[model samples]
Target: MTLAEDEALAAAPDTPDDALIRLLSHRSWQVRWNAAQNRGASDAVRLAALATGDKDLAAAVGQLGDALSSTVLEAVFEHPKRDGREQLGCIAHDRTTQERLASDPDLKVRASLAGNNEDVPEDLVRKLAADRRAEVRACVACRHALPEDLVITLASDRSALVRWWLIFTRNTREVAELLRDDPDEVVRDQARGVLGEPPD
Candidate 1:
């Protein structure tokens, strides 16, 4: 942070205006950050810096006016970096992006999309309810607006945990009686609690 270091950052690099872009590949995050903040930086410069997995520079890129558009979000989901792909399902407002991420091949990312209720597509959620992965089905059980039929489907999910997650949902009354005989003792116990006391 000394004047000498500031001057070093300001000095022209051999690569024309590409100095800021090239600095994004530097070994030190400090150098990459200083370049990200350079007044003359371009979107190309910022995006290159963002793709580096530097949290601060990524935050800076996210603050840009056009950040998080569907295409950019898609690229983030497609990127080789884990941090970028992990951010895919967290985007709430863009239905196009949400739909794209919902079909992602990665099970973890699909589970994240399964749980998002805001502006999320119902068809996509329903499709996710049938995902081969029990973890994704468990997340579908956690969604607030699920259809009653889907709730029943989850009630019988092969994974005990997936079936157990359905206990927190309220509209499973039609299936609650069947769950009384569930092979899993904990699921049977949860079904009793969800159904309350039987007629005396």
Candidate 2:
């Protein structure tokens, strides 16, 4: 690792807030990201300053993630800046932030929102299930917290991998009937295994 990388890793969570705040302006993006993550609430003011001034989008987003309250996130989410909204959405847990991400013009950002699973709303999960990207849809399929109806929809997806993943999840019964004639043999095998039937 480079000297900068070593310094970033050496900075601990308990390090003085101002020291961490100073590191946020380090030339290395990795150091700035690490410093932002370590700042927590103590460095919120410094983070808010960076969120508005940092030229690097990732660094700005990282600063927003470390903000003391949803206040900084809310500010960045509505900032006319436009460049960092997607990255901000990737970390912001507030419902309004999530709603904006769900409808973002960028599919990758929408996919990032879907991938979070924990704070993303069920309606958004359902919407992402129909996304053209298999990776995004797979995220929704493998989300254990998703409602049974959403799981059932994903279980019937054309992607065999998605169906197979759903077979191993808790709500297998919801899609048991749908998988009886799955086009992929491996998926059918998994469904049968989950249903306790002898494998073919």
Candidate 3:
């Protein structure tokens, strides 16, 4: 093994199941991604790594193919830490958790839940599509699975920034075409540019 590989193994979680955790704090992105694809890694490690919210770390961990249990996932969402809001958002695709947090009295949690894409509850996302807060609704717009109709609606949102981001979603075709005549020159210009070809 190379010297860097040894250092990463040193950084790996030291639980009794450390071997199964497959922590991805490695020097190499490819190594981290490869580890996440390691079938031997346990669900606990995948969830824990995802909770850490590292860019490359999460890219690796979030792509893990292992099945997550409600017990492990619940612990991740309920962990009493300042980062709880961020962590819960990462895994909010969990139907039960997404639904529970959709109405969380805390606006931060509600907004946080808007960022997850996987396993997203359709109704919650639809509801958040028209959230009272522009920021929250913007988060829903950033979603990969946001409904096509919501994209069209948010294209006309009061927030220009929210309208600006709709250009990135696959659901943006109609919205982009519709925004071609928006009063905001930037939105109109971008929408016209996007109308040049179908969204990828």
Q: Rate the local accuracy (lDDT) of all candidates.
A: 0.66, 0.63, 0.62
Candidate 3 global CA lDDT score: 0.62
lDDT per residue for candidate 3 within 1-200, as digits (tens), equals 78576545534544333653443566666655555545555665666665656545554443331244565455444544424444455564556666766776566666777865456677878887777777777788777776667877888899877777776554346777777787787777787777784322
Number of clashes recorded per candidate: 0, 0, 0
Instruction: Report the C-alpha lDDT of model 2 over 1-200, residue by residue, as the tens digit.
Output: 68565465525666666666666666676666666556442546344445646645333553354343666555555555544565654566667667777777766667666765367777777878888877677766666587767776787787887777677654355576678568888878777776777667
Residues 43-131 of candidate 1 have per-residue lDDT tens digits of: 56656766777666654443332245545544455555544444446555466666766777888778877875445678888888888
**Model 3 CA deviation exceeding 4 Å by range:** 1-82, 105-108, 170-173, 196-200
Instruction: Name model 1 segments beyond 4 Å from true.
Output: 1-42, 54-67, 169-175, 196-200
Candidates, ranked, lDDT: 1, 2, 3
Please give the ranking of all candidate structures by TM-score, highest first, separated by commas.
1, 2, 3
Question: Which candidate number has the best lDDT?
Answer: 1
Off by more than 4 A, model 2: 1-30, 38-60, 63-91, 171-174
The ten-residue window of minimal lDDT in model 3 covers: 59-68
Best by TM-score: 1
Between candidates 1 and 3, name the one with more favorable TM-score: 1
TM-score of 2: 0.62
Model 3 TM-score relative to the real fold: 0.56
